[model samples]
Target chain A: MIRHHLSDALLMGYSAGQLPEAFNLVVASHISMCDECRARLASFDAVGGALLDASVDDLGESDAAVPESSLAATMARIRAAGPVERTRPQVAPRRGLLPAPLSRYVGGDLDAIRWKPVGGGVRQAILPTDKAASARLLFIPAGAAVPDHGHRGTELTLVLQGAFSDASERFGPGDLEIATAADEHSPVAEQGMDCICLAATDAPLKFNTLLPRMLQPFLRI
Target chain B: MVRSESVTRADKPGEASVSKLVGKDEMNGTAEWVAEMLLVASNSDEAAFAHLFGHFGPRVKAFLIKSGTEPAVAEECMQEVMATVWQKAHMFDPARASVATWIFTIARNRRIDILRRSRRPEPEDLPWGPEPEADPADAVSLQQESRILGEALKDLPDKQRELIEKAYFGDMTHGEIARVTGLPLGTIKSRIRLALEKLRQSMT
Candidate 1:
């Protein structure tokens, strides 16, 4: 059973278009693999519909742009643009645990990733995305542990393959762990298999130990 | 949430004009009429398309502007969105969503596209939000769900609702909301989370 899940705040953030770019990627990938979250998000969208339908106060026509030419201009544009092709809803599901949303980031599947060694047995490949936030694909060999570190800002870590145990709890595929400024943990990959995770962080990691702290600046984690 | 009767009443602003020729007897069918207008517009029916443009255009513009879009850009986006509505009308299913929900989503997506294009200097960029999925479900069920959600939202405390409105309608981040409201980040998250929990409990 998929126990660990996205916090209500994250899902709501995703639904409302309020999340920053990097965190949104984690949410999208997790939702694709978790049906429960998908259903929950659908409910949120329904609420959005309800809000739009009832909201008459904000949509005051008096303040809206009413130049009649806009209608004509829009009509001309639509006429000029010609027809839009209908989109197919769902393709056959890809073989990988990384959903289409995440797969595109790495170019293809698990084998397609070009992992860069950060430290110890933990390796990561930073995905090119918004400069305000950063995302990366992490690979940890079995029995390897990430250094115990706190967060200066929020970091969302989603496991795409294998399982890992942190101070909080064990997380598997589709499980999301939200580590904020108050939280600190060293996550260890379960011995049965290699662990691969998609992580997004807005700030540098705050290492708890002297060795990791000294190495942190060069590690750029 | 939507009372069945309020839903019929919800279309008053749109049907009030169409009712001039179609008569008041057809007013209850207003939601279906909007969906049909999309279908008709797909077939290049200029009158039907123009009517849709007139009704949804201004509202979409206002919605975009509330999200920090400039009026000029919002106006441009509004036109672009309506044009997409016409071109992709076949995708609009009255059964799976109400007209308001459908149009709101279209407007939201269009605004996001515009925002992304303006910000991202990269040639190959991925979207930040969940891509719209094509779910085909019963029309009345989705409407009832939306109405229930609306009702659930009404029951929430004003303080909680204010946060939600900022997050959803105004496009404020949790941190941004904290800065503006002078509340701590933890407090803002807790309030919104609690209110959402109540909404989830009541709706499901």
Candidate 2:
């Protein structure tokens, strides 16, 4: 069981569809690993559904956007989807710990990724998401220390494999370590296993060193 | 004619917390009705689907509009959302959630997927993933949890509830909520945090 689970607030953001894609990816993947959170999310989803029920029907501006033939249009879309196909989820993970939700981004599993070195023996592949935020698959060799940095905004780093010890805690698979302006620490990969994490950041890192600052512009991370 | 009593109970001054007072048995029946309708729809039963569409579509459109999406976009998104619900009907498990909750979740996620589709220009099935597998717990237990959550939401003070709505239903960030409500960011955070924490305790 993952000790540090996503909070109800964050999960609410997720079920409400308010979370950025990066955080969404992290939460989705974590839910796949953590059943407790998954169940909790179901509760949140139920709450969302009930709220929708309680919401009064107002044929307001948004309702004006719908064509009178919306039901017909929906039926048309379903018919176009074909009759006999077993619902193949658009983004299916053929097989891996990546889970189906995160796999679609990388196009495949761990081996499919073509990682590039980002200094300090750490390698990263920036996953294409959106301008609102950036997501990447990061790899840290055993015993390597990530450059100490503070977050300018929000950063969610979810461990996919192995473990890493930050300033105060060791994060293992399914553990998501969130960092904000208030927290800054060098996350060091524990010895005996390589640490792989799916990291997402809404803003650039506030690095303490001169070298990292200079490279930030070119790296666009 | 099968209306939701729990929904109306919110306004029934005497039933300030009808969600808690209502036993699991009454809710289980409601949960099953929607589930069966979805199951029938999955088999291409038009009448059942139309029933769901009639109930959920307008609400979904209103929700999107409230969340700040353009009216046309909300309507368009609502259609797409209902379409997915129709196609994915077989996936709905009442054991995990009530039908209203499931449909609401689909609309919310579909809205997100549509928004992202514009930003990343990629054909993706997002807001899309397999629904969670049913927990080992009995069906009644799941319904009970849902009831608790619904009541927990009702028990929140009106101001807190408003902020929670903006947070979840309006899909606004803390900053966006602060801007709209004209309150300090910290106050916004506390209200929502306390509300959610209450929900958390209720679940436990």
Candidate 3:
């Protein structure tokens, strides 16, 4: 089985308009199977177009390029249109957990926090950061060990609040740790506050502990 | 020497004379006129805005459809994109891209946003702020087909080429293409399968 989908590379081709017609068909087919790739493709298209639009020339030479309307008027229209917040409707909050507002930086419910019990009295919510598989955010409570495991994905964590320490590095609020899939490390939150972090994961976690490995089926983390 | 096309007089009750000017082409007419009107609109000319709206609105709508937007969504997004154009007329820097590319980009972004929203559950509101103003430095520099896939596309088996164009440009589904093209669905699928492999190898 192909371990990783090739849709991202295909999307890059599409965005560049370099994908030949034959390849374009295959990429489209692959996109139907891969939600992650679909979202990335959408992002690439949006960002690429916006970049192109920003570079265009002004309307004619004789006219001074200023709109007839005042800035206040435009702002008023936007205000009337209301704040364009892109938050998805929640499915009822899971049992005892409170529903957190999904992040707008990524698309849709893909950013929702899915909490799973890891081990050692710790529960982790996997938060997808964006459409691209590069990053995810993991939230863990105080004094919890995330199990002795290595990542099967790239992991970048931004400590939102509280502190956590791995063998070599100590992470505090606002500190970011960038780790690759090959990195082998386990993190434990300090005794004080819960460690909340934004992490980007490229794939599943490879648990090194037998207990976590056994629990993986039930925990679904 | 030009003959008079028309002459309107006040009190003498004389008939008007028509003047004919030679070498006038329609191509030279609308582009220059539209460009002039946009210039005026940019200068805060209210009349110019009206003129531009009457002319470009339909064209923009058609452009959106061609770019793969659904009709209803395209219409709504077109309005918003035009409003944005009006609001940000002063910020347009001509050194980077042509006017068509700029307008097309706005429509494209709006379409993407709508697509993203449709994929998820409808929320009470969208969370992101309005798209930021365009950066001056990020203009599309690569206009030429850098990878040159012409030969690769030509080399594709006819069955593969037909399915691809229908799928990508025509926006037909695999099953739909099968019905219309009279090819077995599996045959269509595998043709595309091999086509992609060959194309990727060549392009990369």
Highest DockQ model number = 2
Model 1 chain B lDDT-worst window of ten: B120-129
- A26-76: candidate 3 lDDT, tens digit per residue: 344334333344434543343233223222222222121223443334345
Model 3 error, position A173 (Å) = 2.1
Across B17-117, the per-residue lDDT of candidate 2 in tens digits comes to: 32334444474444444444443434466755776677677778877776667877887788888877777776655455666777787777666666663
Where model 2 places Cα greater than 4 Å from the true spot, the runs are A57-95, B1-29, B38-43, B69-76, B113-137, B174-204
| The best candidate in terms of lDDT | 2
Tens-digit lDDT string for candidate 2 (A6-122): 766667667777766777777888776765666666656666765676564434444444466888887887788776343544544235867666778888889988898989899
Candidate 2's displacement at residue B42, Å, is 5.9
Q: Which of the predicted structures, 1 or 2, would earn the higher TM-score when compared with the native?
A: 1
DockQ for each numbered candidate = 0.23, 0.26, 0.04
The DockQ-derived docking category for candidate 2 is acceptable
TM-score-wise, the better of 2 and 3 is 2
Question: Candidate 1 on A23-70: residue-level lDDT in tens?
Answer: 778888887776566556555555555565545455566656657898
Deviation (Å) of B110 in candidate 3:
2.2
**Root mean square deviation (Cα) for candidate 1:** 8.1
Per-model lDDT: 0.65, 0.66, 0.42
